[model samples]
Target: MHQLIASPHNGAFLVARPGARAGMRIPRALYEQVASIAESGAPLPPWLLEGARTAWDLDLAGLTMRDTVLVRPETGLGYGRATYEINKGCNFNCEHCYLAERRFEGLPWVGKARLLRLLRDAGVLWLQFTGGEPLIDRDFMDAYTFAHRSGMLIEILTNGSRLHRPEVIALLRELPPYKVTVSLYGATPDSFDSLTRRKGAFKLVERGLAAAREAGLPLELALIFTRHNAHEVDAMRAVADRYGAARTEYGTISPTYSGTPEPLAAQAPGFLDKTGVFQGCPAGHTFFHVDPHGLATMCKVGRENPVDLMAEGLDGLLRLPGIADAQMLRTGGCGGCQLSGTCRVCRPLAKAYQEAKAPLNTYCRHGNEEA
Candidate 1:
């Protein structure tokens, strides 16, 4: 059965099945209205009801048994959301970072404004501000204020190291984000600081989280997986609950975006799903990732090639030659891969062909097994 849910961060998303791996974002009010109508057992116009169901790829008329959802949010490209990495420079030196090459240097305010304008013009409703740490940007507030005034719902992904500062907290209080997602590396200062490699960084994260909560901002916590902190997984979740986070996101570490195995040594056991089969990646179609340098790609990982957003405008980049080739899923070498069912590898990662033309075996349960 299909159900509409408000993610812990309060975004409206629809799940086709009870435990579907992915959910489609939808307009919150519309989803609630549909659910309320369903609960009341009052029949609405058939076309209206069917429209929501067919919003994605699940055509109820054609695939009667396959569950589907239709997202009709107010914002998005032809689709409703976009992720912008505000800056690549980060305060922490985590051993598992994919963008280790990112220095604090990034696009200037004018460049950022241009990018934001492009997204707004594309009809995007949800704008996620991510970073090495977005708060560190000298002009973060300026960019943020612009996006907020542009009428886009804003989301934030941060390390929570700087939220304790009065100025940072004050800015958030003035223009609250739709949600503030903090990455939890460990539960205790020792465990956490070890991963971050900075003394007392954990305390800063704690203060940051507390400051956000005290400010009454929507908050969620995600546990970043690493072999160094595997023992503290449960305790980290407990910390998330203590903060009353709306949702808790956690996942295993994967190879670097460069397809290097250097970081694989930090991966925990049981990271990938063996039972799942390959499904098409949603990057470029339902989602896209843009970095601090104005380089756009399907996702953050395996970024061998990217559309230069500054050199070529959004329209020009989207229309560039070989655009389709860059986004296509590469599974020919996977031995009729079942890993796609639960695999984290996408078109770019697959194209990188790490681990001998298969997804990184460290993250893939079937990486070493024959099909």
Candidate 2:
């Protein structure tokens, strides 16, 4: 599937296929040329033929495409979905959480309301509410309601611990999110508590999931596989099935957002399977991440440089110094490596390697081959 993404190098837009190692930069003139022909049901001109393969694998000659979202352009940014981390303080501190020590000292409710208005006006259609746990955020309901009323589809990324709260359940019942994803730390109390390092959190999650289902909210379950809970994969899926969860996903642990390597040691056996190619990343392009305190950057993983939303207004935050220059990192040895073919390490993950300086054998399947 082709996705329209803003070029990080410049504010210009690029049409990129999912998982493409590189994106072809399309000039504005070229886009208009293709669009004009597409609308008129006329064949592409001869000059356009030479650029077709390099620009994108488009059948320019046939020119049957219509209603191109890329051509419509939103705020001249081309962003469809935006994820906001409302809060960073989580009740259950999972041992392998990426945002272990990350903190959020952000705007107050009034300022947040303004930011929501800005996002709505800027044409952000799908808004994702995420955090240490969005359910526990003090102004979550307000933000959720505001985003929904602003004509944005809302999705919540949260652990189910607070889902059982009366007000939280009521909010879900009143204005349901597009979907709610509950991260299941473990299936059993002992394993769950061990992973979160919190006593009696498993019960809260159980109650929260039940409450979500009771509220007629669409539910999804994601089980994070670590050395602590790899054995519970099947059991967790069964539990999700019983709850009638719409989807269940299993993901392996990655380096912490703090740039620490400690959590990498807790990976499950064979976690680093040779998945696929190590295409750069789509951080600032397709979707951008905003941490609490409005530190908007490429993504949460390799948050090396962030543009302060408060300092640099969203008017052109994406084109600011730190942001506009931010690209999928190809740092150090990765610039020209023989193992590039099988390397699944992306820019953010590569930053983790630079931080720890630990050999990739511990975390990468391709790196293991070299070892």
Candidate 3:
């Protein structure tokens, strides 16, 4: 398979570091899929290093990456869903962290400089930063600086603990974010802290949020419907009201994490409200997730090896991954299920169905359900 060992960036060859350990070996077929994304002949960085197979380096030029191997690109240019684990780890041990058990073990800080360069070079317009808690990133300014300079709009999905402090708040007002998506587990620090397993997280998060508002950044509130917090969602709304962020609005949790402790099955049939106007969960096809390991997939739901990203040059993320190719959650459970409105359909779980796996049956009854 053809591999571009390194691409020159800013007139400097970005060769893999001297001790660059080999990435998960990509199959020939998968490598071809990635090639199609870079068919436009976009000047690419040498992100891949090839192992000597058959004693020769395969030339990658003119090798079209197949569209079938990549995730579907977003319809409108200048706007697409982008999620990055900015910190590669989180400080809080939130009760629902799917990556919590493996948080500390993901890839180390890859430097915001390279991440933003890749995103800009790939033509990404909007970016979503998620983590166990992204505020804790020491090199966060570097990332913010790069994304802003590259004309990328930022959306921070944060826990709000860091934004509450007056000093942090003052600094936030000085360098306002384009938008903030705060995940509010509970309004009061007592409930929020208990749910997050951190004693003063609630207070810190709340204060950090006040700081963001005091700075006038547009803010959106994301409420995950869990048994522990569903009972007081209105209180969470009250927290939003205090910020005068009426223009910003609501969000839902993903049902894929229901395997944990949530009583949605007993609370309501669906976590989504019928009046809501959002379409089905279309993340994988519309958004891409690159793990700290650099394994690119259609969305955060996926748990498979390099899907079609190697050959694609990071731009062909617009096509859909084939049904048989995904290692994800079940489909019978979500193929035609009724929870689209409540739970953000887990692409990983949906991959299960696309690949003909057994339905991992689950029932979440959080909030009010129509049927």
Candidate 4:
């Protein structure tokens, strides 16, 4: 197992540890030198040895390049980030889940290995594993280990129900992830269980959080506020603080990825935050999302014109940028809207709202006016 990874990120070179949040950006000359040293089976340079110790408290003193460092080859692909849904299966049935269906279907282990290799070949370094609940997937551990060994910094988006399991904790301890982001539904059992429609759900979450905290895992909390638990927002914050994990609050609820409007009913009345101006994102150009069955899309929202990675391989991603640009055009209901200049939502998101027949005030400046 390598302790450090040196990879080309976008147009730059970065040296990072597997589980660390911070990385050292090195010059092109230094990256080349490091690569040469790895090829020559020489010891790591003194600068990297001392820097790793000071920056991440990692001691790489006498380790040679072959044993200490994994030099990731540049694939010439611009992609640097990706999100893969291991499976759209969750142990809980949260009313506001963005996935309309929670089917426990995905590629077999052999196909999953092929997909991971394809992602690595596509120059994906920052990878996130998400799902209805990723941890519930039977092959999650195997897939995660493969990705981590492939030199990708991984972040797991989970519901925290299974974090208390000894096997999960042991694997996470052995090969730490960059982050484990858990969704906080409610602070108390009654509210949480009621919201998830799963009895004893809160206890499991609490136990999971406690175990993760004790294990010193890199954890974060996504406080999902809905009508079901809006009153407990403060309590949720307190829970996050208690665990010493970073927290982010999400109040607005969007329709499912399939454009189903049922999830919108759970939105908290006055808790919706105002979205900022529409700056562009590098969804398909530099980042992309892959579903459980190896279908790659621009992002989680714009699921149109997917590239079947399993069938078409890494070359299929060449179609993504064009598909992404086409999806972002201000067409359909937003085609002639003059206010699109200042529209907060992107075209893909707006299309979902339009498909759901969501109230204009929720996503448009026109309020209740007809489109």
**How do the predictions measure up, each by TM-score?**
0.73, 0.75, 0.60, 0.96
lDDT of model number 4: 0.90
Output the number of the TM-score-best candidate.
4
Q: TM-score of model 3 relative to the true fold?
A: 0.60
Q: Candidate 2 has which clashing residue pairs, if any?
A: none
Candidate 1, residues 40-143: lDDT per residue as tens digits? 43444344346536643333443221122222233323424678898888889877776646588888888989988876665555678998899889978899
Best by lDDT: 4
* Number of clashing pairs per prediction, in order: 11, 0, 31, 0
Over 4 Å off, model 1? 1-79, 271-278, 320-325, 331-344, 351-360, 366-371
Model 2 misplaced regions, further than 4 Å: 1-74, 100-104, 320-326, 367-371
Per-residue lDDT over 255-336 for candidate 2, one digit per residue giving the tens place of the 0 to 100 score: 6765676677667876554556665555676567777777777776756677676666675555633453354646575777
Model 3: ten consecutive residues of lowest lDDT: 11-20
**1-371 per-residue lDDT for model 4 (tens digits):** 88999999999999999989998999988888888877656889988998798879998877789988988988868899999998998889988887879999999999999999999999999999999789888899999999999999999998999999999999999999999999999988888998798999999999999999999999999999988888998999999999999999988888887788988988888876666778788999999999999999999999999999999998899999999999999999999887776777888988988899998776674322354
Cα TM-score of candidate 4 = 0.96
Name the regions of candidate 3 deviating beyond 4 angstroms: 1-79, 100-102, 105-112, 165-175, 247-286, 307-347, 350-371
The per-model lDDT (C-alpha) reads 0.65, 0.67, 0.50, 0.90
